[model samples]
Target: MIVPSSNLTMETELPRMLRAREEAEPGDRFVFHSARARMQHVTPEQLLAMNQQATRAAAELADGRPDVVATACLVAIMAQGPGYHCTAEDDITGALRAEGCSAPVVSSAGALLSGIAALSARKVAILTPYMKPLTKAVADYIEDAGIEVVDAVSLEVPDNLAVARLDPADLREHHRKLDLARADALVLSACVQMPSLPAIQPVEDEVGIPVLSAATATAFRILTELGLPPRVPGVGRLLSGVEEPAA
Candidate 1:
């Protein structure tokens, strides 16, 4: 697991989900590696410039030959353009391969869109800890996936670490205030740095709709790519598909 230096949540949230799974099967173990990212009011240029350095740092961490690498920042890659995750994933994979390390690469932005599509979500409500500009980028990325972002809100937090420290309970409250009548699903939290995993299912139940977070969707994507079952009870129907769990 490799993440942006400014990202303070993925390092903790991802492992929380993995560990919850490991508790069911103690044999599984998880670890992480982080690389620097210019996340403080990150500009498009700054994000692209950081990718090469981030990839290099990830290669150093792959000295142990991990099975896969995940690019944890969603907007950083999405801000580049539509379908940019394909190129970003390729670049990261190529970097790792050049270092004699072969691993599938997953981007949170790509994974979030994939997760939404997998569930056949057509209309969604979104919440983000980003400023209006970055949040629009995320909404556009989702719209590029053919999903309608019917409603959206941003907490307006600019500091990366501060975004990570946002209370999940507060997020749920903010979610409660959103209009969900036309939304088929609620993107309870869009940014990985926003604390959301702990609040998704409850919010879903209360809103009577499927709720998803960046971390939860990323987990779903990683497990799917790993040829493993994605179901982990308590997250939402996305993990446990309408027909069957993601085995």
Candidate 2:
């Protein structure tokens, strides 16, 4: 797994998910590489500019020849517009190919949408560790997928490190504050930096609906694409096939 340099959560959470995979064998492990990007003031122009350099960094990591690489920034790519993950994945794949590496590419944003769709959820409430602007971008991206963003709350944390430092308990508290009355599902937490995996099942049990985070969704998508069982017990019902696994 290769991630953007500014990413602080994937390194920790993704490994935990992979390690917790009940069916994973010893050799089935995950490794990560980070590419530079700015987490503060994430604009579409800035994100695109950062992507050019980030992909180059990924190309360097591709030299080691990972079986697959995941672009971990969700809102950064989604800020470009709807369906941008396809283009982003293509670009990264092309860059790897140019560097004599053939690795499948996946994006966090693409995985989140696919995960939600797989659950057949149409209305959702979201909790994000980003500021209002970035959170809005994420909400818009999901809404573009034909899913209704029933409600959303942003922690307004501007510092990337600060976002990563947030307690999962606090995130669950904020998630509990969101208006989920009409929501068919809850995006429990969307940012990878927010440390959501630990709170997923508990929050779902309390809210009586499915819950997901960027990390869990990405893991689900990557595992499904790899033709492996998507079950990662204790993460959430989403990965355990309580709702539905990705097709």
Top lDDT model: 1
lDDT of 1: 0.79
Q: Candidate 1 residues 133-169, lDDT tens each?
A: 8889989988987899999998888877788778888
Q: How many Å off is the CA of 143 in candidate 1?
A: 0.8
Q: State the lDDT of candidate 2 residue by residue for 1-247, as single tens digits.
A: 5455556788888878888773445546655555555544445566677666656767776888877778888877887888888888888888899898877887898989988987788999999877788888889989988999999998887766677788887766788779999998898778766778788988988888888888999988888767676778887777885444435
| Clash count per candidate | 0, 1
Compared with the true structure, all predictions reach lDDT values of: 0.79, 0.79
C-alpha displacement of 163 in model 1, angstroms? 0.8
> What are the models' TM-scores?
0.91, 0.90
Pick out the ten consecutive residues of candidate 1 with the lowest summed lDDT.
Answer: 238-247
Q: Model 1, 154: alpha-carbon shift in Å?
A: 1.2
lDDT (Cα, 0-100) at 49 in candidate 1: 72
